[model samples]
Target: MAKSTRGRVNAQGDGTSGLGMVVRFTPKARSEGVQQLEKGGFRVASSKDFRSAVAVPNDFDGADVQYFERFGIAIVRRDGERLKPMLQNAMQRKVISAARPERSYRALGGPQTMRLDLAQVGGVATSLDRDYLLGYRDAVNELVDRLLGKKGAEGLVARAAFDETSNTWGLQAIRAIEGDLSGAGIKVAVLDTGFDETHQDFVGRSVTKKLFATRSSEGDVHGHGTHCIGTACGPLRPTSGPRYGIAHEAEIYAGKVLGDDGFGTDRSVIAGMEWALDEGCHVISMSLGAATQFGDAPSDDYEQIGQVCLDAGTLVVAAAGNESSRPQQIAPVGSPANASTILGVGAVDRPFVPASFSCGGLNPGQEVDIAAPGVDIFSSLPDDKYDRWDGTSMATPHVAGVAALIAQSDPKFRGWALWARLIQLTKPLSSPARDVGKGLLQARGSGEV
Candidate 1:
């Protein structure tokens, strides 16, 4: 084995010397005390629930001593002897770094892209060490395993109702277009948390392309996007007939714009949008929103990219948001959703009743476009763990899928034509405030599409 030396790690802090392999440990084995040295000369700098931070002794000339704490244990100093096995064994202990402390943000992606502010406080360190960090890799594998199982299909179908055996809406939507029909032949892009690429629904499915705005390519660290994709166009498995997606056969390009923590930045999102456009996706579905607003319309960043998509014959769909209440707290519709051409979608429950949490119209006039069944909607999940989640994040895809269906049903319609067709097909809502603009999403005249 190559000789080991104590030195700096990667910018992300994997603990590798410039010329040596970085050491790592399994989560279960990270706590064993590797060495114990007296603490008389050190100053305890901080303390947290599990570990205590201490400044190394000024005279700490050797690398033989080990340090201990609840969060992690490590060898801080060693004698003049070369540390081959010592360094290799030290890798078994959770390797902590002065920079890039472990947090969910780092694993999902770096904080800069996610837009989270990290203020340094003298106290407990981050939970993730190299091994636990590597656990994300295992976590992703577990998700794939679950997605590959038979229950994966049943899990999504079960979301229609708590106990209902029938996936009525999902079934109806699939039947509307079951055969060989090229609808618009448009690319539908889904920018959400992540997706289980191993799911049978997506097996052999053409991923015209995919890009992770974050560091990892793991499937939905959270279920938001997975569920949305299922609603938009989860493939048809053998056992699960007809209860797949609104645009069951349409091609899907997934962009992981959000982190496992389900929070991401305007920059990362813009990057995702740009990638989707570059990939030639015809329609972009974003089941995400930002509370921060710009001027009367979307900011330049939102407008610029959205316009590019629109100009390129791509339609952008965004969630109206899930932050509405009395006196009407408007969260500005945000970014691409607020762009002139992009469609901002609101949410209504299964019974067609406007959901109280659904964000209201951007302005007093007819600003918000359509509403869809978002309340506790059932859809696919990561790791094959299925559950119903309620959010406009769930609502936006319904409309995107509808857009895809329209594109497939009427191939002649491109950019604006598809946009206009969807608006014209929707049924107006009884409550003006509840269903601000065009109202509930409906395409095929009184018949199911």
Candidate 2:
């Protein structure tokens, strides 16, 4: 695991007391099967409209098995092990396809979530001195190592700021997007911690939010979701710092898969996926994932579901994970991202150098599909504010926003073609393929819609 950012993850109490178990049904889930399961004292609700996939009232009663009818999958919630056999029976009764316990997912970013530093997620109000010290220490260590020609430093220096302009350096690197394309017609769903409806820049925009995690509503308290949403779909002419959003004119789908604590379960994420698919979002951007040990295969359920998203004309992208600290160690791509069908994105600093903490394509079949600027990225925060942060979590949205742009440019770019076009347009980098897959992302010369 090489000091993985993804250690075992568990969900905060959703005012419920039980375990979350995921079950996939045969073909499309049948009404009789769902009704029968509901009758078994297992109430399920994850804002899923089995008919059209719209966000409805999904207030938790006891525990709702997060159901995704689009994929015939339902995350079963039951007290104790009482209904284990019934679930097993369903697999026999032709209602269930596959079943497994839900794994934990978290908002991936530079901040070691275990510490929960506000500045790490770009909260401008709370700046602790220790944050500076730690950042400096890591920066100095890597800088000196690179200077001394020791370790795997690669003679790279981490910059304090990527750009001095009013936009993020990531947007600067992919300057081609600023032309005519603004992702006006695309819909991007960011399934992470909830979003901040109070953010000033996003006011009056076409933003839709839904809570899959246990929370009062679709709001960001942990700050990761707001930051990620800002990078992916924030405003272009904001009343703030550099422009951070990619698909500035695109509709925003903020799915609160991870709770305010920045942690979520498979139940929340999968349920969110269902909701996004139902909403007909063109791109589903997930800057969240679970850790994976070496030799760990990607989740069968996630892999299948990712392919399903692609088959349905939506592209799913995820953080390759900030699990590895380079110069001495490297880690496998994380779960969900590690899944072959999902596009895994690694992180590079503003200098176009692979981040010391960015995981690589060490695991077979879990190769990093792309790389993007993730270091010291400045973006919107909750209280009409902005700050700089780091991690592959930041990189995932950059690619996702680009996907939306390419999707809007032409209809043919949907599904895997979008992936192919992106690969075709990347500017080659000197970094190893394992670190920067297909090179840095570049916007097409013309966004001819």
Q: How many clashing residue pairs appear in each of the predictions shown?
A: 12, 8
Write model 2 residue lDDT over 87-182, tens digit each, in one string. 666666767666666667888884432233465455365645654654665677567656865532122343433345676778877664457788
| Alpha-carbon RMSD, candidate 2 | 6.9
Candidate 1's C-alpha runs over 4 A off are 1-164, 168-184, 236-244, 292-297, 326-332, 362-366, 445-448
Model 1 lowest lDDT segment of ten: 103-112
> lDDT (0-100) at residue 383 of candidate 1?
58
Q: On a 0 to 100 scale, what is the lDDT of residue 337 in model 1?
A: 57
- Top TM-score hit: 2
- Give each model's whole-structure lDDT: 0.53, 0.75
* Cα lDDT for residue 306, candidate 2: 89
* Model 1 RMSD, rounded to 1 decimal: 21.0
* Weakest 10 consecutive residues of candidate 2 by summed lDDT: 1-10
* Top of the candidates by lDDT: 2
Query: Candidate 2, clashing residue pairs?
Result: 43-64, 44-64, 44-65, 45-64, 166-242, 166-243, 167-242, 167-243
